[model samples]
Target: MSILFQAYPLARAALFSMDAETAHEVTLSTLQRAYDCGVTRKLMHEQPETPTTLMGLTLRNPVGLAAGLDKNGAHIDALGNLGFGFVEVGTVTPRAQPGNPKPRIFRLPRAQALINRLGFNNLGLETFIANVQRSQWRQQGGILGLNIGKNADTPIERAADDYVLGLAGVYPHADYVTVNISSPNTKNLRALQGEDELAALLAQLRDKRAELADQHQRHVPLLVKIAPDLTDAQIDAIADLLPRHGIDGVIATNTTLSRDAVTGLPHAEEAGGLSGPPVHELSLGVIAKLRQRMGTDYPIIGVGGIVSGKQAREKIAAGANAVQVYTGLIYRGPALVSECVQAIRGM
Candidate 1:
């Protein structure tokens, strides 16, 4: 634990010095190499206590490395060993494309947050699946969720096709799949969250899910990842739609465009989705609102701005059955995983 704590500042400094996008790549690459050399496997073996289950799938722990961190499924095995119960990869599109541009991701160290408009930049669906097929960490029994999205240039009118394509391609490999319409970087993508559009999209996806389950002789749960920036009315609409569309769960938030808590921070004005401490309360509010609308039985994976055991508990109390962490991991490191798990165990 002491060694892990000591590594935090050094890792932060090294990654902090580089451009945010470049630093993300560097960090994944470094982890991949460590994985290849058998280091990360050993870490997983050492962290054996970090395991839990949700949504009928067993997770190594409740805290997962969220989507966007390993968008292409490149580091699942390595990350699994890092003690995450699950590792969600990709806002993967049917076709790969370079996202926004350089300087698209910004760091707000003081706020322990990040603002990224990295518009689903990845090596496309085929490449992502190939990586997943070749992963050394297969059969770890940890939950693996593929987060699917439409390409940026894809028109919203035809966005359901992209999601269908993603569903068809990823259903066989994923423990579950997430439909990500919440990201702020994609142009007008969140408009899909509107009543008519969301209803249509989820209905089509559920139909596809039924088809795939029949074809593959299995059931793969479909989850929707929503944004923290929603109004109560918007969240309630989603809750009402979930059962009708056969959706299994909700990932209660991707990130927020709100800069409320980080108002005066260095990168406060950066144009992208804001995450970390600034989003904690707002995210909790969304979870609570969703729970109220959906009732106690609805499963929610609460994310955004979680940084401690107390915060994780707050999310559970608010309505989440499980939780995910990204910015919190960046700010607090792997020990936060164990802290959260221990806290949950106590509860």
Candidate 2:
């Protein structure tokens, strides 16, 4: 086995032993330190290959660090040099708030999955935008996408205001912006997925996009991130609504609240969304549904349960223009990035 693969179990064990949130902070800090000391520069230079483009943005490769990993835009530069094609930061809300009490994040090592009810805990939109503005990676031409959301206390009816505010705040600095409407932790948030609500949200965002384009003299793509638990009817509604509202793309899934695959695991009953192997089929199904509804030409970014090159290929075949990895990155390490990129190249 490669050194990376060998080290993964040890690293995972160490991280898993700590409180999940604390371990996440420690990992981010370590990455930031490595980035500051130029360790990431050497790693990137010595790694497999150079850059590529996706969604009209220049990416160093196709392997992107998904949102929820760096909720507040911390570690963008650090993560960028770790060889991700792009980095998505935040499910940043309009206001900062402590998420659900302790034990919000759970791990099912046997299934290589994570369940997090992080409740959109973030540094808030202002801090998030400032961090992105100050990012060395953004200044250095790295592709960064901002994932935006409403404050936890914000009622579902007025969620569009939060999205619009976030979009406006991040527009000047982001390569593209993602509207995250799928997180299960937020009460009634997924209701936005309904045909009428989703149509209204997209229409509002499209109007904002036009205004931003005119104001900034550039067009920024707006991608909608959905939940894997949606029914065919809901997915069909989304597919039908997307083009009508000029939505740029679709992120096939967020995490799932179902525990279908890890039913007996110790933490399987946790009240957050589950991601990893258990989410594979559902996420793929969502991707396939979106692909069929939107057609091959529409861009679809598949995410969830992608632990290996083969899985990534399956997502591509299922019809993802690009794929994002989170839990898989936790289980597989940086090596999985190159592995999946190579796999996509072969395809």
Candidate 3:
């Protein structure tokens, strides 16, 4: 184990004492410094190569760092060194905008979860792509997924325009692109998941992908990220639409709007999406349903509330071809990545 991984318990204690977002920024900066000083090199020997292929891309392992942790695509090299098979960045928009007000991120220690209304707050496309372009992650044999979202100000009806724009901008650089219609923070963003809205959006994205694929001379698989708060019928409807629209795969979940598991905990009533242990079952349930509906061959990347090696294995058993993590990394640190990779490797 790396010294950093061994020190995480102590590091997490100090980070946990600060505001969630500030601690997040500090961690990123700290990672950059660690990378620059070659401290992250200590972690290299910790990675166990368990090559897995998903959506035509070969991953070093099935464990990935989920989107939203590095929203601007900055810190890709530092984060990739943490032992993820892939690192997905963004939930970025076409234009830059401040997200919701402060006190937006609350940590619930009792439940081991977080409530965040940070609302796709990112530095926008140009800067995001620039940062992505500067990264050596892909060159270093890591899969890179770029997650795109609509601007909060973008009218929900015209949302395709923003996604189409995002697709074009990131196509040349992405190993895969994720259309994030799942985040609960954006007003009416989830509305896009409705049958009619999703149909229209996918249709447009399909057409755009064809054009971009032809232009780039390479096809980048497009995937969709959905929320865990869906009904059985809603899941059925989405499963029916994905392949028809040329979506290469599905990311089983984002975060949840449900607080059922953490009803009495602090910040349980917070208005954003709930992640960590509280949403684990919900994410697993969604993945199982989607796998049942889409059949065994369809690709499904599971993510939500995975904080342990056993939970990562459960995601695979429940039908996730691969898995990703975010809140778990916040609570468990870099060691969680290798734990998950080792667990999934055994399967």
Candidate 4:
């Protein structure tokens, strides 16, 4: 393990002492500087290369950095160096907006979890694309997935317009685009996962992708990110929509509103989505059901509550084509990336 990865406990202690969002900003800024100075290269050991293919895109490995960690795509190259097969950035929207009120993120250390209602706070689509253009992650041969969502001020009825604008703006730069409809932070965003809303959204996206494909002369895959707080019927409903709408893949789970697993833990009652070990089974259940419903060939990227390599393998065992990490990264540090890659490759 690299010295930096090994020192994560101490780093986590320091970061944990600050407010969650502040610590997040500090980490990203420090990482960007570290990468610029070539420090990350020295601190990160060579990760195992286990080439895998998903949704027609080649991944160096099956482990990915889930969206929300680097909301603006600003740290793609830096974060990618920590040994992810891919780094997905953003929940960016059509217009810039400050997210929910302060204290939006809470740490629940005893349960090894976090609850956040960040509400897609980001630098907006144009600035996000500019950051993507400035990054070397794409040229470095790492798969880059851009995740898009609707702006908060946009009414739920007109949500499609924001998504349409998002799709057109990001289609050219993304290796794949993740349509994030499952973030519990955004008001009524999870409603998009409902059958009627989901069907209409996917239909529009399918047509838009067709038009964008013609204009860009390259077909970028579209994947939908769903929530763990879904019923068996809802899971089946989503599975039925993907292929029908020409959706390329599904990211099984964003975060969960259910606190069943951490009922009395600190921050457990917080309003946002709960992530970490708490959501593991919920995510696996969704992945398993999606695989059963979509059959063997449909692409499913599993994410939610993976704090260990064993859990990473569990995602695959439950039928994930690939896996992603966000809360796991926060608690376990960079070493979790290599650990997951090795575990999944070994599988």
Candidate 5:
């Protein structure tokens, strides 16, 4: 536990000194090498049982590593070894993309938060699948969620084409696939969240999923990732459309466009989605509203601002069926996983 917990403050001190994007690459590459050489398990604290079921998938625990951190699915095995019940990867597009320019990711340590407008940078679906095939997570029964998105270069009108291409390619490799339309960095992407466009997008993917399920003789659940900036009426409208579209689940949030939580903190005015502590309340509010509208059976994977076990509990109490983490993993290290597991079960 100390190895997982105590080592981080110094490591974070070093990481925070460098540019956020550089630090991200360096850390992930290190973890990947550790995983490749078979020492990844040593980095994690063993977590207690906190089994959860969502979208017909059985998770060892409800705590998962959220999408975005392992955007290309490059380090799924290493991340899986860190104690996440599931690890969701990618906002991967149909083709490789360099994403936005450098200085795209910023840290606000005082707020225990981060803001990034990475714009779905990835190695495209082909390389992403090859990496997934090379990983040990699936062999070890770690559930995987593959998140898909349209290319930054793709026209908003053709977005469904990219999503369909992604669904077809990843369906054979994924436990589930998330449709990511909520990322603030993607230009006009959130426009898809509007009523008519959302219905059209979901309709295209639903048809593609049905075709893929038959071809693979397997079924993969599709979950939509939504934003925190939505009004109550917009959320309700989307909720009303979910079951009708055969959308199996929803991830309550990606990140927030709202900066009200951070006020005058450093980089608080950065042009990207705000994450960590600032996102918690908005995430809870979204979850509560969605849970009420989606009703008891629909799945919601709650995310945002989960720095400790108590916040994890608050997400569930707000009606999340399962929860995921990214920024908390940054602040608290792997011990956050065990802490969250313990905290949630005790509740």
Candidate 6:
């Protein structure tokens, strides 16, 4: 058995005893420390590697650690060591800012779910790039994705400026840069996904990317992260716009503001995007719809509510090029990474 699974119950017990956000911080810090100390390397069992290529980048596997787990890119190597085929960090802004107030993160243990309104909290792009540069993974040729977002205080009308700046800043560091327009916690950020707005925003970003690619002499793929609450009409619009806008891929979900899946559960009404098992069906449906609309080859990175190997496989069957885990990692620990890799490989 993998080391994380063998020791999960104990680690979970200790983690669960603390409040959700505290537990999250402690876990991240500990993982970073463990990884830095070379302790994780010893504890980890031999990982069977699986390679999959997507977006012109050859990943060691199809499983990846989604953004929000490491907003500042502080733990890339540690997470990379856990055997994810790729790792995405941040929803970082142009400047560091404390996100929404405390109690912003709530755990609904009964649902294996979490509601978080952290509004793109990170140590800004410079600090994020610093961490990225410090990672041994960068030199080792690991696949890394950088997720970018506007600061919460930035008005929706001027959001593109932040995105444009963020895109330019992170272009060199990212194997791909995910434009996070669907995070519900950010005020009207989801509005960017509207057909007209999305087209305009993407048009601007695309032009900027062309200039950057010429200057840097490398084209970093761009992907857009969308919300799960979208209707069929909205999903179809996004699919149509993706290729037109020169967008490389799309992450079918950010999270759901809908509590329909977790109604009556504690913290069910907590304000934020709901993630974990509760979002599984919703995210899967979006992936399926996007695949049907986008046709065979468009890359879709599936995420939301994936808590096991079976769910991970379901994502691919629905047409995801690869799958990412955020809440699944919180609920299942690092073992989820390998389990998902094996499951996807089995397919």
Name the candidate that leads on TM-score: 3
Q: TM-score for every candidate vs. truth?
A: 0.96, 0.96, 0.99, 0.98, 0.97, 0.97
lDDT of 3 by residue, 1-347 (tens): 56678899999999999999999999999999999898885575468889898988999899998999999999999999888899999989999988999979999988889999999899999999999999998988889999999999989988999999999999999999999999999999999999989999999999999999999899999999999999998998999999999899999799898888998887889899999988999999999999999999999999999999999999999999999999999989998999999899888
Candidate 5: stretches off by over 4 Å: 42-45
Segments of candidate 3 deviating more than 4 angstroms: none
Please name the candidate that would achieve the greatest lDDT relative to the true structure.
3
Number of clashing pairs per prediction, in order: 3, 0, 0, 1, 1, 1
RMSD of 2: 1.7
User: 1-347, model 5: which lDDT tens digit per residue?
Assistant: 46546777888899889898999998899777867786657543366667788898999899999999998888898889888889999988989999999879999898899999999989999999898888878778789999999999899999999999999988889999999999999899999999999999998988988888899998899999999899987998899988898999999888999889898998999999999999999999999999988888899999999999999999999999889999988888878988888888888
What lDDT does model 3 reach?
Answer: 0.93
lDDT of all predictions, in order shown?
0.86, 0.86, 0.93, 0.91, 0.90, 0.89
- Residue pairs with clashing backbones, model 6: 276-305
lDDT of 1 by residue, 254-324 (tens): 88988878888887898889988788898899999988888888789999888898888888888888888
Q: Which of the predicted structures, 3 or 4, would earn the higher TM-score when compared with the native? A: 3
In candidate 2, what are the lDDT values of residues 1-347, reduced to their tens digit? Answer: 25534676788789888988899898889778867986567555544554655668777667788999999897788888777777899999989989888879888889989899989998898898888877878666678899999988888899999999989989988899999999999999999999999989998999999999999999998899999999889989999998889888899889998887898998999999999878989999999988888877888888999999999899989999888999998888878887898898788
lDDT of 2: 0.86
Instruction: Give the distance in Å from residue 220's predicted Cα in candidate 6 to where it truly belongs.
Output: 0.4
Worst 10 residues of 5 by lDDT: 40-49
